[model samples]
Target: MKLQTLRLSLALGLASALLAFPTAAHAQPAEDHAPTLAALKALQANAGPGAGVHAGDGSTSWTLSTGTGTVNQNRPIQPDERFRAGSQTKTFVAVAVLKLVEQGAFSLDEPIGGLLPGVVTGNGYDDTAITVRHLLQHTSGIPTNGLPLPQAGPDGTYTLAALVKDGLRFAPAAAPGAAFHYSNTNYEILGLLIEKVTGLPVYEAVTTGVIGPLGLTRTSFPAAGDRAVPEPAVHGYRGARIGGFYFWLDGTVYEPSNFYASGAVISTLKDLTAFYRALIGGEVLTPASLAELERTVQPGAPGVEYGLGITAYALSCGGKAWGHNGAVPGYFTQTLVTKDGRHASVVTNAHLVTNVPSAQMMKVLDTALCESRG
Candidate 1:
């Protein structure tokens, strides 16, 4: 990262830390919030505590948190406690790239191989055949690269370039633009591509471009060697080997640097809701850019499709909630918003083990957006 860019990022994050969101200003008239609260508590019960949430419609917003902060279970999980957003970082990367696109820094249809040169090659991967859109939509055909098990390498395997190179051990999943294969290699490549185009670290680009502009005071990317979660965090957990047996280990101490642009973002429930609301509401993106981000491709799931780093979850009540879900060892989280502005963000304290069931989580979000409709 450039010294100038680092200074700008720190300045923006510090200055915005004191800004407040207009949570209750938009009034949608009173509605029963009991169901929302109930849904969150149910998530806590199954997800191993820290079921923190921030949800709202166009005119109303609210937050709720259940259970205690960590293993000792001494204090309640605060609604604003920061947690890893895992793969959701892709959404931020997509936004940054799109902003650059608006400024003529990128062309979605253009080959990113030309931008990053030899960064993505071998293992049947050819950067020349992959376009920016292919990367964003997970159609680059890069095999799904797995992260080191938290027990093996808590902080993650390595950096974006390292991960891209590591991904070549397996052959390509398919031909570029062949299908939506859901590869982190796609976004890892995006991080490198962004750096090449802007001459700034991907984190710096996202901070100045998205976090700062959105006034997401509580949202940030973890810096290198910053293994400790910032204070007042809802600690995450996963299984770890101990005495020849497995036990719950606090996963919060791992390095976020290894996640790079793929899943290093740390944010609170309120920030999660706010960021997605702003992005989906057209406050952070130009109309054409937003449209490009929302263009969907089937990812082999029922009632679900992916756009540029965004996922559309089918609602039980008839509309789709768009956003992303992230799982980074100890933390499993999701943030979604409808086109009409109804939205929810939830984070469970554990993942990989004693974690929230994917279906249960989907229902938790779906109910948050659907119950009122019924």
Candidate 2:
């Protein structure tokens, strides 16, 4: 039940990326994506056998992919292809909750005990002390047991309640709002809160609150009990070299309930880029709510700040991009958009575990954003 998403090595694999850059950041025109594509291609050794990039703004956009979508065949991963977006779903879920806040469904400072009642008991936790803001900001003092304990029901689907219960089994990581502790339990609780208020499933509530409003055409959630990836997907793979032979495990059909509200979003590069752009551009939330989301704090990560569900990454090239990185089992996705409207989303059909050069992925994002003129 362990996922290889953000539990990644930040070790920079900069040699290949530094040598591969073909253009200065100032030379890239608004419409040119070739440079970004080149950076993505250079990461094939780590991100293969499937990788894609979808970037640009509302005026112009570009899509490119290298490597095969299948294990044996040479079917290339293409643009607008669907893949699991992992924890990127958190930003969407956070927006959904904030939209509910705008609608006065509940306040961000409301205690969980008041909102859901009786759900936040025991485990040395105080529901009243844990606010919605704490959960969103990962300061809820919840342990990180949510991912390790994936207790699915008989149908292989995980209930948000079950996920939260497993998370509560462990004692508080710290006193409420004491430290930045990224845990799936906080989001699972938010998912439950979303359900309680809207009387709709998490997926339905998010669609009505965020996706539909944003016109994310190809983004969707897999229906309950369904494990099939939608058509034209970048099939995720996990590979290992044993002795002299190499093997790959296709995780494209990974269970939708595996991460529930904490992850488990099926999306495309185009859809994700557009969503992040809108989010960073202030189209998704009210000015007040968006301000609340951007009230960030250092999460003990270098050049990165944790906000509500999104993160702000300080680019080495200067400036910051707001978005989230996502990974399930085999799929990994990174999306970042500047406040100035430039955005980039890079997705690969492989977990960033093992010796995979995750820093190359970061380089792709930096190069894409830095190279953009708009």
On residues 1-374, what C-alpha lDDT tens digit does candidate 1 reach at each position?
23354345445554332221112111122554666667766665566435666677787776666655565445556657888889889999999989888999769998987888877776677778899999999998887876552222444445667766766666888898988788777887888888887888778888988898888888888765667778779888654222423234466877776677888999887888888888888988889999999999999989999999999988888978899999877788998998888888878777754334777677778877775352
TM-score of each model, in listed order: 0.85, 0.88
Task: List candidate 1 stretches off by more than 4 Å.
Answer: 1-32, 149-157, 239-247, 354-356, 372-374
Per-residue C-alpha lDDT of model 2 across residues 1-374, encoded as one tens digit per residue? 23343322112322221111111121123455666767887765566466777666556766666666665566656657888898999999999989889999889898989998988889799998999999999999997764455577787778888888888998998998899999988998999999999999998888777888788888986655678778878877665433433345566777777688888788888898889888878877889999999999889979999999999999877889999998777787889988888788988777845666668888888888887755
Total clashes for model 2? 0
> Which predicted model would earn the best TM-score?
2
Assess the local accuracy of residue 186 in candidate 1 as a C-alpha lDDT between 0 and 100. Answer: 82
lDDT of 1: 0.75
